[model samples]
Target: MTLKELLSPVKALKTLSFATESLILTWKEIASLFGLNQDIYTNPLHKPLAKPVTAILIGAGHRGNIYADYAFIRPDEVKMVGIADPNAVRNGRFARKHDLPAENRFYNWEDVFKREKFADAVIIATPDNLHFEPCIKALEMGYDVLLEKPAAPTEEQCRIILETAKRTGRIVSVCHVLRYSPYFRQLKQILEAKTIGEIISVQHLEPIEYVHMTHSYVRGNWRNSKTTSPIILAKSCHDTDILRWLINEPAQHVQCFGGLSWFKAANAPEGSTERCIDGCAVEGECPFSALQIYYRDKKRLYVFDLPDDTRKWNKIILRNLKKTNYGKCVYRMDNDQPDHLTVNMQFDKNITASFSMEAFTSYEGRCTRIMGTKGDIVGNMETYTVTDFKTGRETSWSLKTDYHGGGDHRLMQDWVQAVGHQNAQILSSTIDVSVESHLMAFAAEKSRLNKTIEPVILGV
Candidate 1:
């Protein structure tokens, strides 16, 4: 039978309410029938703080701006007191948005530190290689921190930050925003309740969309492992964390396999030049054509803002295209990180999990399948389905939100609350827990390099 024909009975069964028909309710629907729907993870309706927890923003780039934007929405919860970035334009934009005065804006993080502590906390959104110093210094200066993830580029650096947080008695929350998302929160709740019996295995994939991969790993700031970090650590540490969280156990061993299979000089189209803006024969056919992505369609323009003068904007863009790596042919760039990877892991209690990251997908998001003794759950960021193994019944749910399933905003709110209350436990992605996943990513990279199974050694 065709797939649709086979699923017709299942559809009919789902439509019949338990009270009206002799139907086998799915484990998920049965849970709902038992009023599980009423129990959801709710954020605290925090009363306005008597004095808002003030913060300094370091590395006022895309990620930093995202965290700082929360102040625009809820100014009473947290305030942006100081801004620091090497880029004058970016720093000025953030300062103007928050109405930061001249004294509160600095060109470098060191200058921000030169002054005595001006804020209750710091949001360290510097690049991977730049995380260690500012985080350690901020901790020493009596500032709690919300450090952007991969915590640091190296395992040792991650440890130093964790140790500093401990010694200084400061709360250092990593931006594992997925943990704060409602979808993952509900999934954790279901697992905790044993609604799916015991988890046996998990299959997760992070599909880095083609254009996105080209924009980020291929041509953008994260193009080099030596300068930044591995693609796995840079992009998928959150995936490792989610797997560990769902399994509720420490990962014992891991094996990984991948390489720079595409997006290299060997894979470039015949007759294509090093840069796409040069009259390339395949510009129209090529999806990774920098001209198409950056100039023609204007899709990924987060790196620089388009100027109001069309003529000036075009001139600036063309100049950048000639001088910068962003305009290079994807297959001719100097990127070293793999465009595809797979990791197999064994957690404590013999639970197993597998994860994959690929750059050839049509859309961006994560897809996951969790199998338990009695039921299985399958989901993406937007929706999920639960099936009871015995009855073949299914229940599904859909969620709608913008940007990481509302995780970015949720994480900021939680950090504000945690910092305001001086309570570290209120934060979801604490440094201690987040560091484990970073270690796993490191181990995974080791496994990929040596072609051997590696043990995950958590430092803190």
Candidate 2:
């Protein structure tokens, strides 16, 4: 087939299961036929897109804004042409930042599609529950999608998204951004080369720092499991996807055990009030006090839509605390998310993996250890060391971390190229592969709730 025909979605999906080596070879051979340099097709940066790939932002929140920032950083690679957000403050800020025309600024996500396909892709960074609708709608409307993680709140919805992407032949790139990070990419390379011998077992940890747990899971948008999703899927699906990617195999079974260990009403300190701003006796002492986290320290103040006036910062925060969930006592909130959880998974070929998500840590970074027959590897997010069993020699590497270990912007780079070129193979985290991690997460949650070993089933 010609290069153009081979890059089509229907043809690309047929080779989705091909190893990266085989895929690259095929791409190289095909490029030679067209008198194209191999690197031009394989490395997106080597060949620029004919024009910047334009996108419409569906949810101009934290992630949406983060991804859209790439447009400003590299205007020649990608551009933001439209935005849709219900919150006036957020929508207006995003519209102004992107210099979007009045007609392109939408109050509802549905309105963006009401007119016509205006952009090459649509970024769905809406809430966990809002993912499926926008993603399906965008794909059906002939716009590629950059979907935020957790794919959806449930397995059925995730499967539907996967099926729709396959049938519609649209590229649905899930934000498993870590796969694009230098740290994890190097780790995967080591595993792929058998530098550690045959894979035996893996251990991974995600330290969801104490303050972050309180802000996001206990008092913020994802506070309730039903309203959002289980902590495993909401916070640690990235870990699951990383494990699956490193193993290069699907998980066959999963079992986990954990629950609300603390941060419940029963754990409330003596003399604590329902809200931290209510002069609770423990406000000064409590680490989870909204006053301490938001007002005094200004840690997660980004979640609040405070006015631009510098002098009003203190007043705005105080007023926000009094009315919003951010001001509530962590111990008294209706949060059911587990503060700590552990998971054991069995992958194909007798490979085993264990994962832990801890919310009580003072630090936030992934810690990982991989053991094989001939060697082992261990590392924190910044640096990793590998030991050869035969040579008794150790090799270590260190990398700098940016947003999501520098995966955020890198992902945006690859995604824009993929959409601009109409090639899904450029992405490592397309829905077909990414949905496996979601399936693993669902099975883990089921095992946690049912107190039984659960098989990792992929379809609805």
Candidate 3:
């Protein structure tokens, strides 16, 4: 039976009655009835690797370690052959987890690259500024790369990485994990099925939780654009990518406006100290108080991983609280990234999109609204409601998993499979495909800085 015919009966019901009945059709059932639940798009036929696809990891930091841990989960699919990082503790932890010998663990990428290439691929999860060189070098060494996002901190560097990938005929996949997410994948399927008819516009918001902003951007590694990249490129390039992917068009121009408004010295409470560890009168009331976020919450201890011994952990955390940036009062920090940002984009085919990222939100997740000629979609990362304009009937789907909406692990699996088969085509966020989003982010930043509409210059 045709999908349209199958849905005809449901559509014929009154809107009020259909809403209740539609709840009976699970997302899977709706997809299946519409012939959209099959895995035909995801299941690419390729020759499996003769042996597990081995990889060398650069930067054993948070992101790097997360990707490395995937090997521990599915060792038969991919193997961690080498690791390089400056931090002894982080480097040792990953190396030990992967059972790497001393010979395979180096203190820096320079030292690791001095040896003859031994791994099939290199996973470059280094910082924003460090991405380009290692990626180009890895490709030159005849290794495919799974690079973390922003590609690089600049458009020129992004171009170089893409050019080098082409020159060396190597695969370079960017970590646009959202593309591999089930929620987003299903959304794409529904859109392609014309349930949304012709999409006219989209509005997307990324709520950067208040505490998260204080942790990552206010007092953390990505605090300054001069050292890293703009907030838009560092944080919200994934959103730009998602918007473009949903619209299925290249962005022609972008305009943006934002600045560091809340997390400045001017916004500090009366008698507030530079560090939260100090006896500040308002520490009890401050939402961005480092003490409450890092010390009070044990789950948040991942960022400050101390020894498991209670006494040692407490002592170390207290000592570090007085010394590290993590304990700094968010308002007194030297952070330059915007606490809020808004962007508008015009894409090919007259499709328009607007995006907002705010740091003062109660929750962390993306909320999106897509308006089409025949229907509309509205949802957060967890669930979405699709309503057909003509029938006024709605269908809803809820996603159970919340780890980047199940994108994180799925992206790792897809990358492993692609590398194992020497087939980059299996990846949804290949460097060539993802670099356009990077360019769009660059243009957005340019627009914000110059107060003018900036044209997107795509390299691929």
Candidate 4:
């Protein structure tokens, strides 16, 4: 497809134009021609109404890989116009894998936005602190954005990004990929039906609380708060967003307390080296082995996969464990962001929710208890358990999600659909929806420091 045609889904299809009426039949025929009938022709949602888009990916680090996979293969709706990351080596590899033309590959996001003149969209998957600059600039440059979560490091930064999004009239979607999950969507609808009868309060416990946090924030590059934002913002933004979604409450005041308790310098074994492989011992005994485990080959990758999964990380690690150091020694790295954290949020619904985030737990998953005046609902999202207090009955269901709660595929398809019809999902609306969760995260730091509750709204 031509570059301009690649920007708009409705205009990109070579065969089907607006005047054409037999789209389903045309799709079936086209799908049969490529032997992709099963993959493409089955759903009205899957077919591209127009031309596919060409997206420029920024910060091809860990999360960048996920955004790239969805943009390129899963959606089959966006061309990978290019990729830009400060680490040329890393993004360069991505370019090579995607077969992007050399000119399409860039060393910095600014160069791509400034020099290249344009792209249909930009996926800002950089570090938390580095997000605002590229996001604002790219929106102004006319590229719709799909930003990684914890939209910005601070409240002001979050506002800046949101303001620019409005002025530009371009889209900006946060990587709060959970909102797209069927599992969660069902839960939201159930709660909205007053399943528990107006949530009076909520208690959320993220065990090792979502394994990725332990992998990335607790023991990975984002381990230190100084390097990024707090552990809450860096890792638990998804969890925070969940609170907002389930409770339908804007966080008012939040109080949190956490510290680098378990994975500290004092905890390190004397014989162990700063590096993992050169350690004194415990390669087999200790579960947190970095060299023997997590990154023996490549570092941490994204959790979700597209085409029907919330995350592919579990599969990726299991498949490549011997090749990468995924579960090795934890003490060798400069770990810091709190092995545990607790946040108390008072929502506008007048419901108070307490979230407990921990990274050191042996068991990995999420557990939440929601109490209402008339009844209650207790759920273990990882295990798929739901209990109702009103009926005193329990219902159990598990989502067979391959990646991102099996929602990535649907999410990508819809994004293409949105780009096709200009009907973007409200969840990815890129303004307050993105800003609120992050502001709470930044406020959590202050609350922890002052030993008091910091208001999420601060003012409103």
Error of 3 at 169 (Å): 0.6
Cα lDDT of candidate 3 equals 0.84
Q: List where candidate 2 sits over 4 angstroms from the true fold.
A: 1-46, 307-309, 400-405
lDDT, residue 326, candidate 1: 84
Instruction: Give each prediction's root-mean-square deviation over alpha carbons.
Output: 5.3, 9.9, 3.1, 13.0
Give candidate 4 regions above 4 Å deviation. Answer: 1-48, 71-76, 86-93, 209-215, 279-284, 295-333, 385-390, 400-405, 423-429, 458-460
Candidate 1 vs 2: which has more lDDT: 2
Candidate 2 pairs with clashing backbones: none
Query: Model 3: how far is 426 from its true place, Å?
Result: 1.0
Compute the lDDT for candidate 4. 0.66
TM-score against truth, every candidate: 0.91, 0.88, 0.93, 0.77
lDDT for 55 in candidate 2 is 97
Error of 2 at 40 (Å): 16
Q: Write the per-residue lDDT of candidate 1 for residues 1-460, one digit (tens) a residue.
A: 4668446654434455322423334334444543465334455544458887899999998899999989888888889999999998898888898999999999988888999998999999988888889999999999999999878998889888888898999999999988876667767877877777999999999999999999989999899999999999999999999999989999999999998898888888887988897888898999888888888887777676556677776677777788888898998888998999999999998999999999999998799999999899898967777767776656565664222356798899888888898887778767888999999999999999999999998766
Each model's backbone clash number: 0, 0, 0, 33
lDDT of candidate 3 over 1-460, digit per residue (tens): 4667546753433333464744534555567545675552356544456778899999888788888778767778889999999888888888788889999999988887789998999999888888888888899989899999989999888998889888888889999987777678878888888878998999999999988888889998889888999999999999999998889889999999998888898989998998987899899998888888877874356666686577777777777789889889988877899999999999999999999999999998899999999999998978888887776667777776322344666688788888888778888877777899999999999999999999998774
Give the lowest summed-lDDT range of ten residues in model 1.
18-27
Winner on lDDT between 2 and 4 is 2
**Model 2 C-alpha lDDT per residue in residues 345-391, reported as the tens digit of each score:** 99999999999999999999899999989899898867777776875
Tell me, by TM-score, which candidate is best: 3
